[model samples]
Target: MFLDRVADNFLTQLVSEPTREGAPLDLLFTNREGLVSHVMVGGCLGKSDHEMIEFLIRGEVRRGVSRTATLDFQRADFGLFRSLVDRVPWEAVLKGKGVQESWTFFKKEILKAQEQAVPMCRKTSRKGRRLTWLNREIWLELRKKKRVYDLWKKGQATQEDYKDVMSNKRRAKGNLHPLLDVGGNIVTKDEEKAEVLNAFFASVFNSKTSCSQDTQPPELKDRDREQNEAPIMQGEMVTDLLHHLDTHESMGPDGIHSRVLRDLVEVLTKPLSIIYYRIIES
Candidate 1:
């Protein structure tokens, strides 16, 4: 209950906190970009709200709290359930008709968090004339905590979720056609086009009747020369150079362009991986 109180207080602080610096508060739980946060509640059965709260706290701390993110109660409750043994008050809370009704509202929310594999917590609010399991404050605070949903939200990703998503995205991306760069313009392929009609319209109506091909820009030509002339560096060296370019003090157009070229060249020129180990007698 102490942890629940802390969770409540934390939620209250986030919701009541005045908007400063012209940033608006986030009211919706969509988990998109913005100033305000969206929290969730989740957990399995047979766990205390405190255990749920602790899991959330630990999760949020690990994930990095931000003004833009938060947790949903349904999700939080699930984490609580997973962390504790069956026989806690959580199950009792679901015993009564009123409690079951309360559970109905959160059922979808619980399912969503599990599907996404995010940490969850259990929450309880003032049970009175007007049922209030989760309020704006608690919702806001959950969003403020960040780590609980960090992996859950893509924007909502818990750290692992983020990595897993990125890995999948990367793997999926590997199947995707390489980004096509024609001259200096960025153009999405027909396959990536969101709407087929819009894509067709762009192809037929928006396209220029006759456009001259741009001569290779001086910057690009120089890059081409460097790529052509430079000997292939070892994988480790290429990675080190990439790190250096990325972390350079002056991060500007030139630096970014160089880094991109370096990375691309490294990828293009690197030899295929071969796994061979020599046997040695001790």
Candidate 2:
């Protein structure tokens, strides 16, 4: 359960930074549903991005169990934690030159921590086991529970009413959450699973491209919109054509005939004419 909390905190906070150094950065948890919560990173060097994350992840796992928490402590099944980790595009996002090097070191460190936690499991878990099947089932159960919750919310069920129903269901099953069933035998439908996977990757590549004045340098933010309306053409010659088209008089300051002029240029200057123009007022 704390692993779930840790993973949730990671995604909710860490993914937005373009660089690792940007993490361990202060995060604002403002969701009205009370799902948003903050966890501070402690006992960290707080010097580099990777160090901070490792500190946070390790801290979450070991929190409040220090007497029991040792290099020999049995880590909670890596299943829950790994699921959360997989949702992050760690490899793809960290492909930057500096990050890649840091990541290599980070992975080794993480694996070492894993080894320290459960030395025997570290050795045997590599051969793989039947537990993967169980984990899959658990994920499926979670999907189903999520769907039911979604429908109830959509039906405008009151939070108290929904909680009561969920509580009854939990009691009948003797489980806290069906999605997190200990047995892990719930089968997930393909579509719902795909949606969850898609949302994760979408979040991975989803940096804000819109250069807001507050966030981006003012000059960089507005240049593309104010200058070129035409899409860039590829190839050396084709690129020239884009520039030529931009500069062509037909697309000049104002012209009812502008559209026609552009069409004509496209046809007549099919090879030689390349529009290179910036729409800047003199």
Candidate 3:
């Protein structure tokens, strides 16, 4: 029954002539949507007898342009940031507050500090094509090769010249192969490659289960957990953590860079520790 319906709907012929000398072939098909507006049949290339078919798809489809907010680290002023933090009356503002209140107040102060210190700029996203290995030299070589190939195609260059340029182009492409997995296998398909990469990273970043299993025995786990969950974060510990922060790391959505925190660590450690204790208690 399904075969009869399909035959009734799709058996209608679109092409009028045989692609070759004999045996008429209907290579193109279109439904009621009219996705393919028109078709062109032309002579085959070289010594081939089959006709070349060109389908014209209706309407235009374009990719969406993406933009991202990025911090202007080059124009940042760390000295001004220190002054901004110093101006804040953290003791008076955050005193006599519950954990949530203290956290909210601390966040507000940090935001204020960020506004004064960091500037943000919006730019079109690069579509993730800015690979570390795709440098200017390689791009220039690729452009040169493309120009030579185009010239050869237009009959301005000889076969030898075209082959040489193509060889160089292939070598440039070989340098930009897909990323290898931890098992040293080259992932080819885009979806499979992305899944492999995401799975590997997920295992690395998800440390809760792994840490509990490896670091704590069943008998002492509860006691160790209690100790680990102690409310008070020492000022020295906060300062040490701040000092270890990478200054070159990118800023978060709040526009606060590690450089800002690192610079004002001495002034912020005590107040931050108080807030941390409040949050823990809450």
Runs in model 1 lying further than 4 Å from the true structure = 1-175, 181-201, 210-269, 272-282
Q: Report the CA-based lDDT of candidate 3 relative to the real structure.
A: 0.70
What TM-score does each of the candidates earn? 0.13, 0.17, 0.41
Please report, as a residue range, the 10-residue window in candidate 3 with the lowest summed lDDT.
222-231
Per-residue lDDT tens digits of candidate 3, residues 1-282? 955865788743366667877656646666546667567777887887788777787877775564666666568787787787788788788778887787677778877877777788764445234663554667787798888878889999998998877776577432222556778565556787788878878886786535664576457443333423543466656776787786755667655677777878977887778787776665
Per-residue alpha-carbon lDDT of candidate 1 for residues 55-107, written as tens digits (9 for 90 to 100):
11212335332342223333434333333322223333433334335334334
Q: Against the true structure, candidate 1 has what lDDT? A: 0.36
TM-score (C-alpha) between model 3 and the true structure: 0.41
Best by lDDT: 3
Order of all candidates by lDDT, from best down to worst?
3, 2, 1
Q: Using alpha carbons, what is the TM-score of model 2?
A: 0.17
Error of 1 at 205 (Å): 2.6
- Of candidates 2 and 1, the better by TM-score: 2
Residue lDDT tens for model 2, 12-108: 3433332335443444332233343343343446554343322123223432322222122244444433343344444344333353354454444
Residue 129's lDDT within candidate 3 is 49
Lowest-sum lDDT 10-residue window in model 1: 273-282
- lDDT score, candidate 2: 0.39
lDDT of 1 at 59: 25
In angstroms, give how far residue 40 of model 1 lies from its true place.
Answer: 83
